[model samples]
Target: MDFDPPSNFSPELMMRDAAAYRPLFYDPNTTFYNGHDDQHPRRFNEEVTNDWYDFLDGKLTREQIAAFMLEGKKVAAIANSSSPKVKAFERFVRLAHQVDNYACTPINPWSYYNNPQSDTPQKTSEELVEEAIRDYRAETNAFLKNRYAFQALKALFYAGNRDAFERFFGEVEPNMPRNTLYYRALGYRAGFYIEVKDFCNANLLYAEVFNHVPAMRPVAATSLTLQDEKQWEQCLRAASPEQKTALWALLAFRTGDNDRAIRSIYQIRPKDPLLSLLVIRFINENEGRRWSLIGPPTKDADPKANHMKEIPRETFDLIRRIASEEKTENPFLWYAAAGYITSWSGDYDGANSLYDKAAGQMKAGNKEAADQLRLLRLVNALSRITEVKGDNVERLTEELRWLYKQNSYPGYGEGGMRYKTAIEQSATYLSTLYAKAGRPELAEMLDHSSEKIAQPGVVDKLIAVLENPRTPMEKLIVDMYPYTAEEFYFYKALQALHADQLIEAEALMKKAGKQGMTELYTNPFNDYILDPLDAHTRKHIKEAKVKYTPITLIQKMREGEAKIARGEEVYNNSLLVGNAFYNMSFYGTSDIWRVPLLNASIFELVPCYAQEMVMTSPAAKKYYRMALKAATTDEQRAKAVFLSIKCDRNDCYLGPIRGRALCDDQRYMNQSNSPNWLDRDGFGELMRYANTQYYRDVIRECGYFQLYVAKHKR
Candidate 1:
């Protein structure tokens, strides 16, 4: 029933740096936040190191502090420590970065609202990414603080410092936006490889990015030629915007299969300069020589303004004239003739029709040169249409959408900003369509629209739709209830959705995407209820040997009711949910099989009630201690505090905290810790109770958490 966020959510937000949260040089007046601020500028005055050490008072034990200090010796062995302070810092980090500390809870967006606001804007996602990149660039210097290490490591990897990259990879936060940055880096790497005449590896990376940012592409041949690389031409063809477009154009031209490419370019908004640039490049490249200002001038513009140098008036007009067409057309002629064209962007189906007619025209004994000229004219006409900016957007929206969807529209070609514009236009069109259609429901359990909810016995109808086989009704229902995984209950909803219920019937048909007024029968129903269990018992299931049976999924979750509970923060779940699964598989693939599904099962199954303890309660205590030891470069003391607390606890339980909980022990991040928090944060056994009990208070608020805890009693 909920609405998805508009697709226009800027990717930059995900890139901001997290180090900005730390106080800038201990300004007590403004210092509300004090986590790892890697971006903190180097100190200006005499170092007031003691101020940091003061913050750790009372929370961490002496033993833990010593353990944290001793741990840094390993890091010191690899990279030259900036100062003795590094060893002291690592000692505390070792203790803090325990597997026990890692387990506890998933992130709760709602909890953020309760916390005191910091004066700082907090790091934007992009800034964080930049910080990571910046870290990568610096070849020397071990990370002084635990908080900023992950970001710096990411930067090192991006900078291609192999030593820093490997070290950082070993310690990266498993859930950091690895894909986002990785793709960009990979794209650059691919381009680099192409430049060096390494076509095979270059293509592999290019193909990888293209898959995620689907409908995405390459670099210039000039550098390759300058380097005297043997495959300079192939690299240029692979990376250059102009060459890539022509290749696609030629592919479409020869085989008449331009659906994918045409659709991709057509998706680009009309005003995008890259679109014009692509056109200009296509023109010059197709002719085997550059042309005078066909569109925008090819001079560099201000990066901030992203200005498009004006095309010559004569060129603009010539293209404009060709754009005013309704006939089926081919756009390549537009480039040959320096004019615009109507019709689609050489879509295979549309281009096939025009290609036949052009062939017939040549068969009539037309002059060979004249026929070639006419053929060029067709290319001009179609290309011009792609170039033309439409009037009255409302009237032209559908046409523009069709145009945007065309293969050769040049929207997503390899130019700098083209893909963005294409993404923007396609997203806008999608938003408009959704608004017009009235927030189309996923046709699971209807809870949003008044019309859907108001019908007689509506809840029942919603239940029947949940039972459908085509859709993931069980999963959907489980999500809606936020309860344990047992498949009973919702009986009232099922009975109501039975045959002869028109409203529910309509909903069922809607799930199936059907238009019907006839047979208003209810969906089939099955019973799955049993007497509720009275006690918890460990009846090991499958290979993992986990599950609290007899207790049922619902009852187990009640065991870990948060001593204090924070409300759920409903961030978009599907993608993040997938990401967690990806991380799990990333860790468990070779080391453990059933990784994706196993991680997915746990991610979805947990009510995440332990968020309070795992993130805020115990973990926060250690974080303050690290900041304190960092004051006099006392890495030794910090390690003791971490080990005292972390060693006694199983780190496997703290995965969510390590992933998103902002723990002091972030230095342990890597592919290995994805499935288990203990592996990420905890050392041995520090907690006084079972791992689940330590965070049990937070888990109880969730019916699902209670079910899991009770059901999975070991």
Candidate 2:
């Protein structure tokens, strides 16, 4: 039931610093096609309109121009629009819409295979394609001509006229500017190669698109499929040197063989920006692989159980050598990565040397780089500690303080910097250290659990340390402890109250201040034990006429016990005391706030507290027996016997065999096949007063008692 929050092995601070290589490599999603940006189309439209605004000499606001294109308004509809640029755009819009009519309806695979019918008539599709081609040839403005050429090729490609599409691309590509639109046309050509089964050329052209256009990388990478080494060699031979390096980069990203790809790309071009992304990605993958080894220590946990894989020696040497050479575009990135890898491999001193080298090479004013190096240094420092002595604990005081401060940083997880993994790992490691150092109370404070603190002396030790912390280690323990001293006092008071230690419970509750004075909705001495699952009981408790705080409830029960001690109204006073204890048990409606660290709303109690809460209430049963011993009439005897039977039934159903059946529905099922209820202590006594009104009421209302009576009479 104890769970740590989601923590990243690769720091987002370092990965996001490679901003230029994003949306292609080192993207957070790392999917085959990085589609994290759903607003790409809207942003693309904005970019297009902004360019148009600049070209038109600010004839209209950018929003207005975008709106004009979005609305598809005709030129003649505009008032006082005599500008030549406006007229040219109007013609372009008409042709663009014509192209869209053909391009928008791609051949749906399901309909094409199932129906084999064209949605648009063949004659109409041919006419639209011809109109686009004619517009491209007649347009005189250079800007409009380029747009027309792209639209014409798009229309041909979508019309299924591949011969015309390829022929027209050849004619226009030589004259077209190498922009996003041109790269898109090349993507279409790549698709043609795919359809013709010329995969080598297809991959070659797709690599070009992937390298040139950042936004188009997803589509290009998705389409670039070199199935085998033969096709890969063919593409390599056909590609230019720059494209060949792009091919290796794409392969590295797709296959995660950064060692091979980095070497290949480095031999080709040492200053390539893509090399930095590959190095970061390689480090991140290895970091994820070795996360458990470097993470918080676990008691009795095998280091080889969860993660046993190791980084290959050759790969480590290659990265370390690359960092040593300092020929990469970002030497600091390489050094930091190599150093982190070295540190996790147990080379603390070597890792520190690499970290110092990285610090020297880090670019000034780069906060991300600075934080990354600091985090690495902290990792190295913590890894250097083999024991939890005073000196070892004091050595990390400032770093531990800095790590704690990151929890409140505005961009702890997603934006500014990521240190959550480091924080969790450090806390776990320190908890283990304190445990090994014979300070289990401090260990439980760092990595806390209700089960551990529920042990006999843990809470007292925690309180003792909080009251008088004498050493630096003890002070740090108090500083890092999550609960306030008052909260521990309240919890300890609740434990004492449950164990029938009234004097100790009262004194501890007094020390708990307002925390121990939380008001209860129902009277604790109510004769009938309310069921939490009953709708009427839930409503009645909310509107109860009487309420008592914990202090007042204990005082009331203490007064009843005092009267019994003085031998005044023994039966009545004893019954009232028994009722108060019963109302605070797990079977009672007012039981929610009775036990500390137990979630009363849940149907079953947690294992550590289940025995005390549900399986037994010796205090309630003991007082009920006193009431039975002092009863003067059959009615008083019947009432005491029936209440005592309620306790017996709870203990039988929730005891070892049945296992925590606290709810009425579960109790009914569990008791159906068993004769155990007939043997409970008070059942025979209740049958002795079968003629009493209390017994008659029990027979009418209680099915199990009614079954007992029928069996006995037969």
Candidate 3:
């Protein structure tokens, strides 16, 4: 088979090829803005070849969408039917990663939201303020192409990158056209001044913002310090009749204006029962009804009770609707049924899809999902009804038998009931199968199988695995998994107390250690091996205490890139950062334990700097090119799609890049990307209404697939 195909292939395989060419594109969890993995270039775009009009027209047929669903030729039909909009956005996302000069890209509905560029770098704070003031006057559209540029400039202002921010602002301001949201941008412009701690300018900008954009006063007020509080309050009192209302409304909320705050909210959305409910809920959630001695005496219990008692009429209506026959399956029921069915049906793919869909419906912090998809494989395997994918059932059985024969014992761990039960059932099945096969040497075969199945000397290991302190006892049990003798030794080291006990166990483990089991015995917790004879010896003690300090992905990728730079070409994504993390240390958990926590503070930092490498590193490019060239599997193709998509976005990837920037900066993205519907603002209902329509559109299209050109190679 050809290791890599030329670009001139059927459109059916184009997405696959692009995916193989750059594996990052198809990652569902990994999102990109205009390509390059959200990393911005330090300099200029190297591959500025295409004008990329195809993205605007949405004419691109991304065949990879098919791979996500069905396999092979079936994908081609799906790709052909996809609308120009889907294709356009996907292509834009891919191109934006590498594209520079966002201004040159064709104007589309989304162009207004696209990030803009600075014509020149400003060098002073005065220059920035002057330029910002001009832009604030010019831009009429609340949304514009320069929004991201403004945002970037705003960030630099906060970072104290004053000169650059100033220079950047100087270029953007004079030229931008005034539009509906121009005042809103000006309001943001004022906020930018505040971020740099410039009070005089901030007040001027805020004055202008209140003059032009009245509703944002409360939001702006929250960011002010105690020193500026009175001036703001005074400004609130002295404002004109128009500004006075909004100004005092915000000040009143700060100075015990609960009624105005409530009224102000009512003015925005006249009958938001949810807002009313939450006001009461907040009182209950934070125990807010209690009054301090500085204010009034408290009857906290009564308010708390009243807050609970005053349920909204809308809520009652919702409670009824939820219980009644709704056409859509309740998220809980759908997931639970899907999980339960997938478990024993050998429908791993289906089960995984169901769980993903369920996750989309789940509320934040809600842990009790319909059912976890984790147990799907186990359920499927046990049911023995769905091993259609390459005869895994026969393979798993034969492999288990062979493993037992090699060990000469198999009852294995008696630790967890699950583990013990699995081993026992496995042995019982093999015994029955062999006995049923019936041969002249059946009795001898049965005896040999029984010896192998008994799990020779495995009780101690089970006890070691179970005794660990963590609720996840599995973390301490290494070899107990996939059941083999070497695992017994790993568990012995982790659970052992006295050096003598360790030494004795060490000898048994070493004697038991065979060729395939050696990798498992290497101390997953520590760097060096433990020989029980010298467990207490200073040398052994010092060695055992050594644990791997995790290094950044950049360092590992640099090493790989350096090798590639030197023309050493054995590069694999798994062996790169993926393997670096994978081999870091598992201690006793599953292989997935090595992957960083998705929402963890540090783990979120991991993908941030990847953008920089994409922009600056030739080795990184070479590696990516080779990876895309070599990718053959559907999973590999998916990764390629992600990388390519990142490259395709017309702007350098900033979000992930900056997120990585703030990784070591020890910052978080406090600015939320939550859909506009969640806020209590008037726009919230409109957003919800729009989203409802969109969702309904999708549901109407659900299982309502349209056929396109049927041929794959065409």
Best-performing candidate as measured by TM-score = 2
Q: Per-residue lDDT tens digits of candidate 1, residues 370-443?
A: 33443333332323332223332233344334433434322221111112322233333333333344422222
lDDT measured at residue 370 in model 3 versus the true structure, 0 to 100: 17
Residues 1-714 of candidate 2: C-alpha lDDT, one tens digit per residue: 012222333344555443435555443344631345444334357667877788778776776677767656533333357888876776677777666655554556577666778554332278878887888899887787888898888788777777998899988988899987898888888888898899888888888887787777767656778689988988889998788888888888777778898898888888787777788777655555455534333233665643434667888898899899999878888898888878867788898999999999988998878877898788778877777866878767777777777753332223455576677777787787887887778888778764556556777888888888877656766787777677778766766776778888778877876767877877777676334556754554553477787787887878888999999999999898888887777676556244444455543444343445544567888888899999999999999888888878876655543423332335435554443777565777788998899888788767788787787788
Off by over 4 Å in 1: 1-310, 319-332, 335-428, 432-552, 555-714
lDDT against true structure, model 3: 0.34
When 1 and 2 are scored with TM-score, the better candidate is 2
Q: What is residue 155's positional error in candidate 3, in angstroms?
A: 19
Ranking by lDDT: 2, 3, 1
Ranking 1 against 3 by TM-score, winner: 1
Model 1: worst 10 consecutive residues (lDDT sum): 523-532
Mark the 10 consecutive residues where model 3 has the least summed lDDT: 1-10
Leading candidate by lDDT: 2
Q: After superposition, how far is residue 484 of candidate 3 from its true place, in Å?
A: 4.3
Q: Residue 206, candidate 2: how far off, in angstroms?
A: 1.9
Reference-based TM-score of each model: 0.22, 0.84, 0.21
Please give the CA lDDT of all the candidate structures: 0.31, 0.72, 0.34
